[model samples]
Target chain A: MHRIGDAPKVRRALVSAAVILSALFLLLPLVAIFAQAFSAGADVFWRNITQPDTLSAIGLTLFITVLTIPVNLVFGVALAWLVTRFRFPGRRLLQTLIDIPFAVSPVVAGLVYLLLYGRNGWIGGWLDTHDIQLMFAWPGILMVTIFVTCPFVARELIPLMQAQGSRDEEAAVTLGASGWTLFRRVTLPNIRWALLYGVILTNARAVGEFGAVSVVSGAIRGQTNTLPLHVELLYQDYNTVGAFASASLLALIALLTLATKAGLEWRAARREA
Target chain B: MSIRLKNIAKTYGKAGRGVSRALEPLDLDIHEGELIGLLGPSGSGKTTLLRIIAGLEAADTMSDRPSSIHFGDRDVTHLHVRDRRIGFVFQHYALFMHMSVFDNVAFGLTALPRKQRPSSGEIRARVQRLLEMVQLESLANRYPAQLSGGQQQRVSLARALALRPDVLLLDEPFGALDAKVRQELRRWLRHLHDELNFTSVFVTHDQEEALELSDRVVVMSNGRIEQIDSPEVLYRSPANRFVFEFLGDVNRLEGHVHDGTLTCGDARLDVDLDEGSHELLLRPHEIKLDEHPTELAHLPVTITAIAPVGAEVRVELEADWLAEPWLATIRHADFERLRIKRGQRLYAIPRQWHQFPAANQRSIASETMS
Candidate 1:
């Protein structure tokens, strides 16, 4: 092939170098966690991972992921549909507010929840009088998880739905589709891949969330502790194998997230093709 | 079904500030089973009018100027698009990219409310029938992305017809196809309309497409209809100068008329008119070229170019008195007989000419015997 630029060799070299460096930067930590987790052998790694506290942490993480994904799915789709399909006052402001969780620190999000639900905080006393526990409990952990992961689905969907536009929906409507029928047959099919994409990202964040869950979880050994908090607790106790093993489980979840996302993206590309 | 639109108008943005009228308050009646073409340039309210009829847009609503749109006897101006029972084909086809051609055509049938909905087996048969109509049955299972642009548009057509809507509206149905494909689709759509005998209103900016496809063509510009007539009448007797100029290529002759003589620069033509500045319009086929001047209206010019294509021979004429070169299309036999060539001097005689006094007013007159 003929060269098309003044310094093609140098440009190619620079791009390759950047790509290689970033790939290493991203992959090194993932490799190290698995390496350290199994350093004492598979038997020890399995033992650490199978411990009752570790198992409970995994369960809490899965439970939170399961609970949060569906809620965010509904909220994300509704918000995206409203923002993109209508012209109303404060529409831009609504879009920006939806992105707040992405911009705010996860720890700050947890603190905001605590300020609203802590024992001495606003509404916390009322909740205590009713014998409802929120702070340092599953509810607090779940709330923080939902807040931080809220934007994933909406953010993915808004631009896509905007780009797709309302033409198909209008076409469907003219063909005698009711509101629900239009959504199920026209709008939903169009956004299904993006919704899957958003769900996967939300699931990954809900499982691997650290700061927010850490603040509200109170590191409660087997109750409020998620996988990340349990990893921290094991490290603090100098149970290195246990800590790495728990960390590896989180890494595995992240890998599964990546795989599912990749699979969805492949299907989306095929659909487009 | 027949449609009657009463005083329908639309405006965008805040009134009296940055508002622009997209459609003037006007009434139109389309007979049942007639295919009408809304022909105009961009922003001329052709697509806007079509959308309003489809219930995709709400017409202007004011206490003093209420708009009503009717399909047969049913008033549907305030009705939702789904309830209005109109089938629309968008310019981009808008076929569901994720759905197979069969499912895309089945969408409308399945979307009907429970009591009105057809059985699954009935839907399957209806979809297959529509697919057969559009000649896309073999590609039933293929997704829209798998087919070519023309095929996708065909699938869209079948889908639109699935519900058996009272009226069908196509917005530049063949706009995205190639020239050959556009011609093919035009013929196909015309055939389908005739076979099904359904009322349809289509919007197009292509004069040829509009004239060829429409039973009656409505020429519009600046949110107002310039003329509405059969294609033959519209071509032969345009209602106004805008309609005349917009329909085809026009040669413009600007001059002052005085004492039965029209003079522009050095060129002169014996035309009886009031003493005032005027512009004469001539179609390419209206000007007859000869070796010498005739007794009627004539102008002398030198040939600049000659293009012999299709059935007509187009000759370009230039003269010092002419502001813009005049184009003339003659028969092939005439071209061979005259031995027309570049730089050949010839005289142009006007068989007839048209003029517009108030821009929108039509004033066509034949030259009087001197």
Candidate 2:
């Protein structure tokens, strides 16, 4: 009953079907974005970038991304080390809480932050007296980006840290290394590549955040709007050239991220070598 | 070197927990400049004992030694594992995957304090010398993953000895290598011991390895020290049943003693003393397998199985003597001289009266049932 068909041919057919489906799912949106970007000429792209509103929006988005990425990178790795390496009470609960942004919709994460930092909300009255604004401000936009991308670094680093055998540290300590030295000399070198890989991934996610930043940003045209929101605003104002141009800029970041991922693979191969 | 443990017990968890005991109380004295083999099956507390001796673990109590280990009077039990100055080679070698073999061997020197530590040149010289000792100087620049299993083990050994530790603890050092590699390393380890003469304690279940390598073998079973004797002393005269069975193969014959000689239905055996409700233990090769019998424990037997293992051949014998089954071993030359056959009847005789304190008496009856 099992010998009716050739096994290798069936396996190839199934594998190719999976490969094609995966390619269509991941590459379709990039194809559409590229198609839209090149639909207009470089002259139209330059015209959009020169517009005052488009320029401010681009500056604002890059500013928020530059602010948010390092914070998320440091914050994510610290949390990853804490949750994975230490024995602490409420560790399981904290692990689940750290992953809440991944489980919740980005819109909901933005709303939760907005409610906490709004004019009449908790911690908002004190800030109001100090003339500090978060909701509808660049602070709120950056905060929303942080919330959405919080788990990326930890999700990458924790398993790598855990998988590194504890014997090296034990051996170090037995060899007269102090606890700090053990962590520095043995633990750090072992996980440095993986930790750097995680930082790269988290920074990419923080810079590319869209839905959460848009909800908290209040869609301020030139001040608080990020790149994704800028693209949408340009589209609604019957500015197809500006919208596609900004979209192409975000796609460039994506391409850089893909290149970084490829570089990371090469580094990994060299490490194994 | 020169260690002592008093009433050392290690119980893992609560009584109602899955395993009640990891190790029971034990007392041991390890001499300086002598290699001791801790022999046991798996889960037999050999590793736990080695860890305790290295001060990597705290015994539940050590009143005699103040819960401490003293390498020439430096109390190290309460000190953290780093300050103990004991070298350890784990079963997996545990070499740093990222570091070169030179750096791995230099790790301990790099880990030492400023005033107490050796200089960079001194560390390099020491690593080179240790690498030469392990015969791994050619592979010093390579990482651990690039080396063979034996080479990795040698690097681990080099790293451990780099510290010039007072004592070395090896937890099944050759257990990870292949059988042929294990045999070669076993000889290399013995040669290295003669060259350096460091106080070493190794744990292994391979009796042949224990006998061939160490000056003394400490046979452990059920978390306690069953017997500690020299390799020759242990094989020629085992202390108990577990030691006898664990060390090598044995054949048993049941008999009762009238006066000072053991008597069965068709056989009478000479013994050092009277034996009642006792079983006789004998080694197979020591027995004489000849058809023209003598007056003794002789039985008309047939060969059931013939297994030729290198120089020795284990000839399983089934006899119409009285009660149960028996096995006998003969050298290749002896089996050839006797012309033993599978179905032909032959006289199975005792080589000598090999007796010891009997354990597993109930299990002997149960063995027949099986």
The model with the greatest DockQ is 1
Model 1 chain A is weakest, by summed lDDT over 10 consecutive residues, at: A1-10
lDDT of 1 by residue, A151-250 (tens): 9999999999999999999988888887888998789988888898999889988998999888887988988899999998999999998999999988
What residue runs in model 1 are displaced by over 4 Å at the alpha carbon? A1-24, A125-130, A267-273, B295-298, B368-370
Q: Write the per-residue lDDT of candidate 2 for residues A1-273, one digit (tens) a residue.
A: 677446998978988998898779877877877677667877777887778887888788778778877897788768977887676779999988988989999888887887888888788777888999999999998888878877877788788877875777767877888877887889778877777776676667776777778778888877777778889898999988778888888888879988988898898899787
lDDT at residue A117 of model 2 (Cα atoms): 88
Q: lDDT for each of the candidates?
A: 0.90, 0.79
**Which residue window of length 10 is worst by lDDT in model 2 chain A?**
A198-207
The clash count for each model shown is: 0, 0
Clashing residue pairs for model 2 = none
What DockQ does model 1 achieve?
0.79
TM-score of each: 0.93, 0.85
TM-score between candidate 2 and the true structure: 0.85
For candidate 2, write residues B1-370 as lDDT tens digits: 6766666778665557665555687777777788999999998899988888776777776355444456556666677787778889989988898899999999999988788898899888889999988888998899999999999999998888888888888999999889999999999988888878788899999999999999999999879888888999888667778888898877777777777666677666655555476676666765667776665444566778888888888877776554655667678888888777777677766656455555533222111100
lDDT of model 2 at position A96:
89
Worst 10 residues of 2 chain B by lDDT: B361-370
Q: Which structure among the candidates has the greatest lDDT? A: 1
Instruction: State the fraction of real interface contacts model 1 keeps.
Output: 0.91
